[model samples]
Each structure stands twice: as structure tokens, then as C-alpha cells.
Target: MIDLDKVAHDYGGGALLSDITLRLEPGSFHFLTGPSGAGKTTFLKLCYAELVPTAGTVRLFGRDLREMRRDDVANTRRRIGVVHQDCQFLDHLTIAENVALPLAVSDRDPGAQADNLSELLDWVGLSAQARARPPELSGGERQRAALARAVMMDPEIVLADEPTGNVDWEMSLRLLQLLVELNRMGKSIVIATHDLNLIRAAKAQIAARVLRIKDRHLQLAGADL
Candidate 1:
């Protein structure tokens, strides 16, 4: 659903991603792996139109990103869900309210989706902590709550950065299973992480392609993954 053609991004000083041509197809699952500061996060940002490439074209849903206006970009983002590395959330809001923030920010009436929010919390195993605030929840709870929030609007694509970085193996697999289930239901997924074991666990359950960013280039990871 997203296409990058010879995409290269420069952060003023130099290019972070060079000659990166990739396509995220419908109903496909991908794992992005790289060392720290290797531009894994940058690649995810490019996918969701958060950062426009400096040297190439990025197309979302067959439309060129460069042609999209401010409102166009905002609307396009609604179709894509993002789970940030920090799990950005309003500290004042409870877990349920935080999960419903997507719907609230969209033009929709948040109250109308109360049932959906509850179901999502249950699905993510955060039902008990719905009344808890972001600061009060554990790392795993926060991450799962973040996932629930990301998908609250029923986005077509889910882009997650270091989603399991702060959690244990059991929680990591739980989150992975949630993503896998979304893929099974036809939502395209791209997860940027350094977790090799998590990638292997996901591979055992589904055919997931692993992409590694090394030497400022994106390539298919070796069989070791």
C-alpha cells in the first residue's frame, strides 16, 4: 500500500537512507531491524509520510506524497496507525481515554465508540487497567494501551517503532500476536525494532519478511533471522 522509489533521506548533514527502494504490499507483514542510530525509525517515518524523502518519491495508496496538501497528509495519517517508541500519551488521560484519542481527534464523536474502545482494551488485555492513567500503568500495559489506541480508528496500515522494546518476552509475544491477527485480517504491518528473537517468534507463526538497515542501505535480512 506504500511505495518508496530510490528513496534517500538527508538530515542536513548527510543522507541517512540511500538508494532505498521498497514496497509494502497489501496483507503483508514486515520486520525492520538495525543497530542503534541505523535509521530504522527514519525508514518508518518515511513510510507513513511523517518525513518526505530528499531524493526520491513516496506514494501512499497510489498517490504521490509530494502532491498531498497539509489536510491531505493529516487525513492520510488517519488511514495509518502509528505506535511510537515512547508510546506518546496524555498523562492526564486514563488508559481508556488515551485509547480513544484517535477517534476524538478525528471528526468522529468519541462517545459513539465507547463500546469499541472497551472491546479493544479487552483484546489487548488492558481491560483491568482502563481506569488507570498512563503513568500508573506498567511498561507492557502502556505498550498494549498504545497499540489499542493506534488501531482505534481501524487504520489500514499499522506502523510501529520499537513496540516491544520495554517489555518482557511474554508481553512481547502477546503484542506480536495482536499484530499477526491484524495482518490475518488484511491490515498491512511494518514494525521497526532491534528484537531478533521477537522477529523469529513472529516468523514461526507467519511468513514475515525481515529487512535490515546496514551501511545506510535497506536489504533483505539473511536466513539467520
Candidate 2:
């Protein structure tokens, strides 16, 4: 769970997010929508402790972000997965190898997690492309691979930033289904996206709360949306 209290973050120029207090409970699903430069990315970074807030507090799973040491932060990160907008992968490594990179980075042997990796690839519908390189993949395939990589460690929370931004409507729904599946399995899901249609689609399958950032604040989106 992530708890933010009166969080205000400024990137030198001005306050990007201000007076934001929110809590992500276990098994909760949320969609964050806002205009470009509205601090959606900043909010996600703060949630995962990638950037410390300029003011206020952030506590992840009951531990204060400001109080955690480097090792503590690294360890905390293992419990949370992130899918970035840009699905960057090493061209030399096969999709399977790239998906298993997180295990290696965590000092866990990839060989030990072969079964899990295989299952994950299949879950994301990328089993057929397991040996393909990143450059050879379509946008949907790349995004699916990125999703596989993010959850390789079996994280408790999954934060996706514009996960379906590059894919078509069909592919977007496919990716959304995967996240919804994760939520059903008890992983907290937070997706930062501008696509209202995607949010509306998710609402039909799950009780997803939609939040919007405006005037440097976070508020629950109207039921009409």
C-alpha cells in the first residue's frame, strides 16, 4: 500500500503537484488522467519513491520514504513493478532474456525462474515471440513484453504509465485485461493514462476508481466520466 499525505512536489520552476493526499489500499485499481505536464508521471514516481516529494510525506507499506536507506529503497522497489511508457530493452537480448532481467538485477538466478518466465510470457500472450529480439516486435508485442518484465518478480503493486499509448484499441483492451487479471490476483494496480475510453472499458470489468489531476491537485473524477 502507498500513503501520501498533503504531498507537494516542485521541480524548481513551480509546484507541479500540491496538497495531494491519497492512499492505495490492497487490491485496489485506479486510473490517473490528466493533461500533458499535469504531474501524472511525478505522482507515479513519488508513489514508487523514484522522486522524493518536495514537501509532505510518502509511506510505502508503512515505511516512510524519507526514512528509508538506499538498500531499503531498493528492497522496497522489489515489491512494486513499473511499466514505463517507453518500452526500452536491449536489442541484443531475446524477449525472454529481457523479461528475466529483473530477476538477474535482484541477484536471483534467471535459471531458477525459467518456469515462471515461461508462464509469464504465455500469460502476456507473447510465448510465441519469446526468442524474438525487441526490435522485431510490434508495438503491442513490445508492450506485452514490457508487462511481462515488470511482473517478473511477482510484485505486489503494478504501476503502469501510459501502458496502452502506442497500441491500437484492440491491443489496448488486451493489455487492460492483463492488468485486470493481475488485480484479481491481489496486485494493486495504478495506470496513468489520458485515454478515457480505456478507463471506461476497465470500469465495465472491475470497480476501478478514476482520479484526475488539475490545478495541481488530485481529485476523484465525476461519476459522469
**Best-fitting candidate, measured by lDDT?**
2
Residue range 1-225, candidate 2, lDDT tens digits: 899999999989999999999999999999999998999999999998999999999999999999999999998988998998888788999999999888978977767888999999999989999999999999999999999998999999999999999999999999999999999999999999999999999999999999999999999999877
Query: Per the 3 Å backbone cut-off, how many clashing residue pairs does candidate 2 have?
Result: 0
User: What is the lDDT for 3 in model 2?
Assistant: 99
Q: Using alpha carbons, what is the TM-score of model 1?
A: 0.97
Per-residue accuracy of model 1 over 84-134 as CA lDDT, tens digit each: 989999999999999998898889887788799999999999999999999
Give Cα-based local distance difference scores for all models: 0.93, 0.94
> Cα-based RMSD of the predictions, in order?
1.1, 1.1
Q: Over the full model, what C-alpha lDDT does candidate 1 score relative to the true structure?
A: 0.93
Off by over 4 Å in 2: none
Query: Candidate 2, 188: how far from true, in Å?
Result: 0.5
- How high is each candidate's TM-score? 0.97, 0.96
* TM-score, prediction 2: 0.96
